[model samples]
Target: MFFFFVGGVEQQVRQVLKYGAGRCITCGSKADLVEYEKVLKAFFVPVWRWPGKEQLLHCNDCNLFFPPQLSADRTTTAVADQPDVLRCRFCKEAVEPEFRFCPFCGSSLS
Candidate 1:
């Protein structure tokens, strides 16, 4: 008897706690406060999901994930102030100030 198995671990965004209007640390684009889940998949189907408690800073442009607590002051202030907001033409989502591209939809902001 022979058996074939495919398994992998995937990190998925569960929810957005807050949307920060600031530049991403990795790509200098927009980022958000996101809750994440770690999923275990086998044979292309999810077997288990582990939801995370703490919110993370996720960069839509570069796909960077880091603890928001690391930059709590900056992110909190940015979310509160929301200076120089720009809207994406394609997705109509809010873009970060001074960004050359829309982080949510990858559209040209210029």
Candidate 2:
């Protein structure tokens, strides 16, 4: 008898609690508050899903996950000084100056 099995956990964004305007502690790029769902996949088919709260800071650039409470101070002033930073339409992350693509979300700046 022979059997093949493939399984892994995947995270899916369920809703955006806040746009990616704040800085991420790990990546130093824009982060967002998102409600996510963790899905367990078996053989490329989703078998189980667990919904998460909307208090996580998701960094699109480095794909890092962290709690928002860790960087509460930085988020309050992330975009206050940078007036030239552009917000990504696709991900709504604040893109730094001179970046053609959003470092956080990889969206086109132009």
Candidate 3:
């Protein structure tokens, strides 16, 4: 349906380095691999897409997966548009948006 734009993913990836290693989604590590799924719609049905259509992130430091950014950027126009994000007290992995608790280590933000 809607393309995020060519190499747009890379541009977004670059933003993370500026933010530094955020809270880890798994094990609450300072670094981690993030995994998530995405879907696209066409005529009211879901279609296969690239990258964000579904994905995983890998971290050399801690060897885990976690969500990336915790804060919204210039692109987001509304509070809702900002991802569901969390910060780990240790290791620093950014947790997923809809997680009830940390997916990596199962630590509760609650």
Task: List, in order, the clash count of every candidate structure.
Answer: 0, 0, 15
Task: Report how far residue 4 has shifted in candidate 1, in Å.
Answer: 3.8
Give one digit per residue, the lDDT tens place, for model 2 in 40-100: 9999999999997556878888777777775464333655666676766555556666789
Q: What is the C-alpha lDDT of each candidate?
A: 0.71, 0.73, 0.43
TM-score of 3: 0.24
Each model's Cα RMSD: 9.1, 8.1, 14.5
Order of quality (TM-score): 2, 1, 3
Candidate 2 weakest lDDT stretch, 10 residues: 70-79
Q: Please give the distance, in angstroms, between residue 32's alpha carbon in candidate 2 and its true position after superposition.
A: 0.5
lDDT (tens digit, per residue) of candidate 1 on 12-100: 88988888734465455677889999899999899999997777888887777777544333335455475466666554456777899
Q: Which regions of candidate 3 fall more than 4 Å away from where they truly are?
A: 1-19, 32-50, 53-58, 69-104, 107-110
> On a 0 to 100 scale, what is the lDDT of residue 23 in model 3?
41
How much is the lDDT of residue 3 in candidate 3?
62
- Give the alpha carbon lDDT tens digit for every residue of 18-47 in model 3: 223444444433543343334455554546
Ranking by lDDT: 2, 1, 3
